[model samples]
Target: MSESSGEKTEQPTQKKLDDARKKGQVAKSQDLVSAALLVGSMGIVFLLTGNFIGGQIVGLTQKSIQQAATFRGELDMATAGDVLLEGLTTLALTLAPLFLVVFILAALVGYIQVGALFSTEALKPDMNRLNPFTAFQQKFFKSRTYIEFAKTILKLVIATGIASYTILGSRHMLPSLARVSPAETSQFILAQIVELGLAVAICFVALGALDFFLQKFLHIQDLKMTKQEVKEEWKEQEGDPHIKAERRALHMELLNEASAQAVRESDVVLVNPTHVAVALRYDRKTMQAPQITAKGADLIAAQIRKVAQEAGVPIKRDVALARALYELEVNSEIPENLYEAIAIVLRWAYTVAETHPRS
Candidate 1:
């Protein structure tokens, strides 16, 4: 038995999911994409800084400052514009690779989560969204809202702890930085930044994974169908069974009526003793071969025999021919393979007719 109207017991069908997707409803996590972008950007930064890229940036900075210093005495609109352009070009060169890496990673993460999807249905305005009461219920009354709140709090606490721990661990090394050479101090700072960034990225990824699963769970829950909805959908897809059964009953009634009429007009009735009966008719000027005028089994076979007897049609007991014709439809021509067998039955019927003519 199906569940009650209020109970959502059925999983969403493929058609249901496809319709939802067309309306821009899909399982995805913004947090996962954010995490991937952050991690990817940080990794790019770390790799660039560890290589000659970092030295190139330092050299560019020094050269810019030297140019600015040289222009101090003769600074003009033209000289300022040139200096600005040089600085902007250097900045673009420094950040372009990191930006590309982050963009690619974000796009890949989005694809993996939801595939390719574009729908304008989500952009359409709904008056329900303007209702304060409905908005309040969605935000506060929903269980998912509470789960999201808990996740936010947990992420804040974890991020704070990680940052605090990293700062405290580096506190001892901070004082020694002033005692070390300038190059050593710079390397130490860069190393600490990398360490902190890596730790934070790992935390984001862990939270993102949990959020992705939570999003999928909520998506499936939202798609569950009630019993009534399932029935309506099934009817739309496969048609109503009650209507189909009625049509079948009408078809059988018409077929039986036609068989009864054929039995009355048959030339000969062939019987499988008691189980089967077939009535055949042949007209030399009309029909090229003998055709079964009626066929039936069991109770219907009894009816065929009675109709044949009342019409004064000749009846012959031939089990093989009777069974074979019983398998054919009314008014169907007998197969060539059964020609000899049916010919024998016709001869016997003709002999009987001559011996006892009908009044």
Candidate 2:
């Protein structure tokens, strides 16, 4: 029956959706994350480290050239190592701003998509993933695999075209750069690179947004369940009807036992003569309002009255109040609208207690 999940004739139930979520399955796109990180970090890096990195590179290049010209110890292995180490350190420091911006952008994008979701279910070992047949099917047979392949090709083409167009636009500037100072050349290259990067990043963002919507639709379709699946899930969560019947019967039996004991402790029993009975309990020192300790009609009403009489608990006859109170649940506080009627009953019970106290 699990194989029939592929049919997906009906929309996914909330239970199925929630179960999938618990198992760390959710709609998300790697392309969208990539696009956001590329666009956001590129903009930030261009603003913060663009000039600094270009200047550093130019300075390092001039220093190296001057050192080579004055190379008294350039041939020594130790001296060569020291220069390489210094250049690497300088390069790393210069690129630190870009690395920081990319990291922050990635984290922010992840947060916006999932909002603190941390699941290890996906990381758990899966035998199916290791199987050659399964891998081949997923790679070549699935519709999603072909869609992804097409998207990747489209993106590559777009990026290549954008880069070529940007470079061609700067062809006239390239001839002038050859005759310019090293610092001026570095600045021109930096400007051109930033321009190309921003253009590509914007294009990727648009592609990513389109991919996200497409993926969302696919995810919904993939998760759809059949009518039989929905019915089985409902029974699993709510229990079979026969089982529910037994549960209800047991619950009522327990309530009957508890009500017997409660009627003995109740302050007063309100009765609709022979049809209804309602037991109320209250204490000035502990309770703010009278509480219905038990209520019933017909046979249950007769049993409640019998228990009340045997326990010496007071019985009051007020058909209107009994009928209203009978409608309330056992052990619930009396409503404010019934306070006036309840107070009168309590006063009467107090008088009876004084007149003929229970032993």
Candidate 3:
């Protein structure tokens, strides 16, 4: 069956997964990144508020207000620009650390989830994305859309509950805030806000963890391959079955041709009458022992005998020795076990050649 015809049953291959990742199609939850940033920023603010960040914010606010109050009735362009620049610089300095912390936390969270990935494919404009039908399908028809909607509702409900609980828990301290100094009142309010923010952030992180797993599960489901797709991928890596069979046939044919030439050069052919044949070559000046030049079974054995006969190479029928040599690979030296048998055959062939001196 074709890939389109069958159900996707097999897990995605490593190559497919890698290709998807290259295109920035990874199982990463935006909610996870947001939650991490929110939690990190809230924690930093909670820790640094009174000691560092809070002082900077208060100073900048007071300076801006004082400058605004001191400005003349008709503000010149130069004075206006100076005020704007001073305010912006102070604000930037005050919030720079917070922004930096949030940025690092967001990047770390994204990296933990999807590793280092930068793909322009997602940024590139696509006509399909502009389609109203496609947008409608994504927004309303997909289960993912419903899941996102549910998650949004869940976040709102949890945040509201956390805020209500924080407010109620601090209810008794409300009257005490009015009795305290201005600085004490500001600190108390800041602490309460931080506490509420931390609670909400904790809830978001828990929800994000769950959502991350869900996204991963959905991604795997989407990447699943059909049986036919697996087969096609196998073919792509290992070649088509028919092509492989033809290559094997060609290899065997080449081996047979080389074996026929080896038989012609051999000094002796040991045969199992009709079943097996082994052609051996021996040169006292060159070879250490009798080497099997060619070996085959059945029809190939008959062909070896015919070639040996045409080349005037002697044929000796020895069932045990022939079977043994047949078991050995072509062009290999005779084994120690068959050395005695092969030596005897060589001796006999040499004797025959000496007695019949060919013209």
Candidate 4:
């Protein structure tokens, strides 16, 4: 069956996954980034700027009041402009650290989830997104819409539970707030606010992790292929001409090496004097007949002759014996029909080996 017509039963191929990634299709949960940013920004505010912000606000209030008090009349445009510029400048300077925290945390969270991915494919406009029918089906007819709804419910329940518990714990301090000094009251309120923020942030992290895993699972499922697709991909890869050529070259190289080694180990190389060469080895202790260790023609025969000369193995020129032995494969024993002829050649080689006895 065609891949598109069949059910997706095979896991996704690496090529398919890589193509999806290049098109900016990835499993990502925005909730995870949001949760991390919320936690980071909250920590920066409470730890570094909790008192600094209040002090800056009070200073800006004093500056505005002084500007009005000095000119004791309806505010002139120039004076108001000066005060406004100062307020804006103060606000920017005061929140610079908070903005930096958010920027850094968001980038870090996104990188941890997707590594280093920069694709503009997602930014390209598509006409399919404009189709109302498609949009409607995606919103109301897809499983993802229900999944989002479930996530929302989970967040709401966790947040409400945290809020309720926090309120009950701080109930006894509510009435005493009026009697306490303003500074102490502010401190108490700040502590309660910090507690709530921390609890909410922690819950968000838990929910975000669950959401991330769910999205990753769905993404893989969506990319799964059918069996036909796997077969087609395999065929295309195996049939590539370049790959086949490489395989052939490697096979030839291995064969040439084996042929050269056999020539060096042969008991004697029987040659046709110029063109054909056949190397034979026999062990009366182990073999009943002589074995053809190597054979070659033309350039390879020259190579085998060269290896035989270097290894001190004797070379004999015999047209009939070399021609007949060359027809057999290397490593095969000579047929019984040729044993008498081979025995004469081997007997002469042994006599030469014993007489010339080189160290």
> Which candidate do you rate higher for lDDT, 2 or 4?
4
Per-residue alpha-carbon lDDT of candidate 2 for residues 174-278, written as tens digits (9 for 90 to 100)? 788779998688668767878888999999989987887887788888898877777788678566687667555644774557878888888899999888999
In candidate 3, stretches whose alpha carbon ends up further than 4 angstroms from where it belongs are 1-5, 65-75, 181-183, 240-359
- Please provide, for model 1 over 18-133, each residue's C-alpha lDDT reduced to its tens digit, 9 standing for 90 to 100: 99999989999888998898798778768767757787778888998898898668899998898889888987887787788789999999999999999999799999899999
lDDT of 3 by residue, 144-210 (tens): 8888899899899999898999999989989888788998887888798898888889889988999
Where in model 2 is the C-alpha error above 4 Å? 1-6, 44-49, 57-71, 74-87, 172-178, 240-359
Each prediction's whole-model lDDT (CA): 0.83, 0.82, 0.84, 0.84
Q: What TM-score goes with each of the models?
A: 0.63, 0.58, 0.62, 0.65
The TM-score of predicted model 3 comes to 0.62
Predicted candidate 4 versus true structure: per-residue lDDT over 218-329, tens digit per residue: 8899899889888888688669897678655644763657876776777899999877989999988998889998887765677678878887788899999899999998
- Candidate 2 C-alpha error for residue 293, in Å: 27
